[model samples]
Target: MENSRRSSLKLFFFVIIFILLAPQALSESDECAAEANNSCNNKARALKLKIIAIVSILMTSMIGVCLPLVTQSVPALSPERSLFVIVKAFASGIILATGFMHVLPDSFDMLSSACLKDNPWHKFPFTGFVAMLSAIVTLAIDSMATSLYAKKQSPGTSGHVVPEGDREMGVEVVSGGENNNFQFHGHHHGSVAVGKDDGSKLLRKRVIAMVLELGIIVHSVVIGLGLGASNNTCTIKGLVAALCFHQMFEGMGLGGCILQAEYKLVKKVVMAFFFSVTTPFGIALGIALSTTYRENSPRALITVGLLNASSAGLLIYMALVDLLAADFMGSKMQGSIKLQIKSLAAVLLGAGGMSLMAKWA
Candidate 1:
């Protein structure tokens, strides 16, 4: 456990050092000179567009994240419903596509940019290497955090977390001691067997959720940096629209994860707020440093590329192993062929929609 903590700390420390190592310069590149001129001519217009992008994207992000959370108030959208299962599967698929179709390719492009060195850069696959290390680090953190949180929980204490939808029914969460069953006591007595996991599974679910948020935050900052640093009004027009949809879809994915994580109101609010503001914060920073920061610069490319690669790995792993497999391989999903079929279709739809968006981005 101590080793795991050290690994997590080291990973973060390394990322900070890597970012600090970036070469800072304000000189514009020759290739970008023409775009820069065009942007200068339409400077006021481009600023207006960027401001619009920030405000609209922020609202869309908030709406997207809050959508699933609001479901806690709707009886029809209860977590136990097949619809919830399908939507979660769809959300997982969206995350999967984000890693595979979006982040991974972007990393490849940036690392392979002509601006980078020919010797070491071309000779090595830094993107894949960094991604692999990041996935391993994420796994370590996930395992360590879950185990620690589970240990901290009092085994003898009984806790009640009444979901909003079940409040009208006076529902109380009942942990099945040393068993895999989760009892929700309402007007009627019944057991919903949560299958093949001890009560610690709930703790694990909560702990693992923060990792998903971490990855999403990293991806958001990268996306925002690109849009913020670019002066090309033509690209910004299309990118702003694409990014709004991007945040909306990704927000749905994160929202679904948060919904299942069983966080308290305060924690949920904090997570959602951080997610809602990350991209905008990144965009603001980019705009402030637009004169000095070049997206295509060797240092900038390396930093963003590595960050994207790491995020891609974390998202891909969580979506596949933690989110999808954990849900699908459970007794309930495996036992129901109809549910499986429905979930697969939902996954396809979500993945296809996100993949299609990649074309414009």
Candidate 2:
């Protein structure tokens, strides 16, 4: 009986030892996890400073972008004013810089980051490929949208009128009236006169403005998210100043486009609001997800990098092909080489200024 009791006591002692040691082991593991979580939380706190900086940047951006749109009420800033053309040229240059220097390079950096795998990302120029495709896609959208709008406006095969000869005479009279209207008021009106020629142009400008805004917003939000999610104080401090200037200049470009669109007051406000809020919203979202969000993580990098690449392509295409090319090649510019040279200088100035900002941003 005593021997049996001793055996039982030994078994109980072993059980007690295991039970105590098990908890201690688990507690140590829990402590390690807690330490890791605390480190993450500290990182998140640092990111909040970036969020604050971005908020300030966005506010200034909003003011800059909305300034031109709201300034239309001033006669000096109206579309017909000569200064308007110069301002537009400058804005276009800024946009050009944004695409080439800011967005495209950032895309290349992200897609080609050393942190990413080598097999596919390093093997291919994904940034350029994506950008090229995006440009092509934007062109398709631009042309198709303009064509669709034209078709809708045109009186089609469902002919309801037989006044063929009078129609030609009426069109001539309307065209003369439109010329007079342009000379006197700097605008064409009357349904027939406005509808035939200026309508399509107006529609095209509106489409361009909206699409450009989309591209800018995508970039702005992505940048804001990066700022808001980053925990690096050194990076954040420089980014704060750089981003402020970045948003201001980019905003001016978008604002110029919006001013040309001639949208209603409500629509103008809405567009300006959208442009202003995108970055702020991104920052807010970043802060909310800071716990789980990793800016350099594989998934986040790929998604944001692709988006930035696409936006850069669209902006570059629009700024070069649509805005700058059209203006430089148009009769207004061709009429005077001096004016063209002046505009070109303005463009270069704007582009140079924006490019300088990229160094810090």
Candidate 3:
């Protein structure tokens, strides 16, 4: 009877403790639920705005990028025309601005966000470093691909020897045996033909277009993801207009590259499709992942910030070195000071516009 009474007493005490803690646990759970509901509401609002922005951006991008390609039919806009050169210069300038003003800055902001740890992030300029590395990688890819193509097309050791009949085209030997001279001329013509077969400027342009598209796509998707994940109405409103203009200008830059490539209709369409849809696709993905994703969360911030930095580096490098420097230094721009100044002004205008958009976007 004594042991049974002690056991009951212990059980009674345990029950009292559980009862005392139950309200606190319930209160915490309720608070968590409220927080989650608020988050969901915010996400829902952002998702709706993102849908509209995606559609608008897609249309703007398609129109902008397709303009130059479609303009090929106009005689004045033909690749060899002066007007075309000027237009291309303007487009290159825009791309240069985008790389420097827009993408790079965004990357810096993301990587340095307070959500991330201070030890490595604040200690080192990871954004700049990543960007620098990306640029170097891009250069490596560009140079190596060009060199490989050159080697593949070279006729060294693989050139075919001409047959006697093909080599001898009826050159009668005159006073000092002009036949030998004729034979030497034939050898020179053969070498010229081989060289023509080996190298092509068209091929180089195509490679450039493909690589540029890849770089552009990286940032496009990231921007779209950001827009999609955001639930702030104030942000979305401003972003809609800024993003529309952003896509349009970027499309123009890409369009200029596509035009230079001289790709077939199918290839042109493919390139255009990629640029147009990347952002929208990113938005869609963000919508799908919104439930689990927290923009300011440590993991999310680090991943996104690093990605932006790397992409920014690539854009900056390509814009300044590959596109601007190459064209401005080329014979076309060098021959005309007026055109150079116009292009410089255009670049500044583009950079300014994009920089302003950064305030909201």
Tens-place lDDT per residue, model 2, 108-137, is: 998998757887999999999999999999
**Which regions of candidate 3 fall more than 4 Å away from where they truly are?**
1-44, 152-200
lDDT (Cα, tens digit) per residue for candidate 3, span 46-84: 767888988898899899899888888999988777676
Q: TM-score of each candidate? A: 0.82, 0.76, 0.75
Tens-digit per-residue lDDT, 1-361, candidate 1: 3333443454456435534543343334622222255434365677788899899999999998889999777877777778888888998898899999989999999898887788888889988998889899999989987766555443444432222233344443445675423444556566443332444666566666678888888888778877777777887888888889878878887887788777666667777887888788667767877778877767677778888999999999998888899889987799999999999999999899889988877
Q: Identify the leading candidate in terms of lDDT.
A: 1
Quick one: best TM-score, which candidate? Answer: 1
- Which 10 successive residues of model 3 have the least lDDT summed? 25-34
lDDT of 2 at 159: 16
lDDT score of residue 208 within candidate 1: 61
lDDT of each: 0.76, 0.70, 0.67
Task: After the best TM-score superposition of candidate 3, give how far the Cα of residue 176 lies from its true spot, in angstroms.
Answer: 24
Q: Could you tell which candidate, 1 or 2, scores higher by lDDT?
A: 1
Give me candidate 2's TM-score against the actual structure.
Answer: 0.76
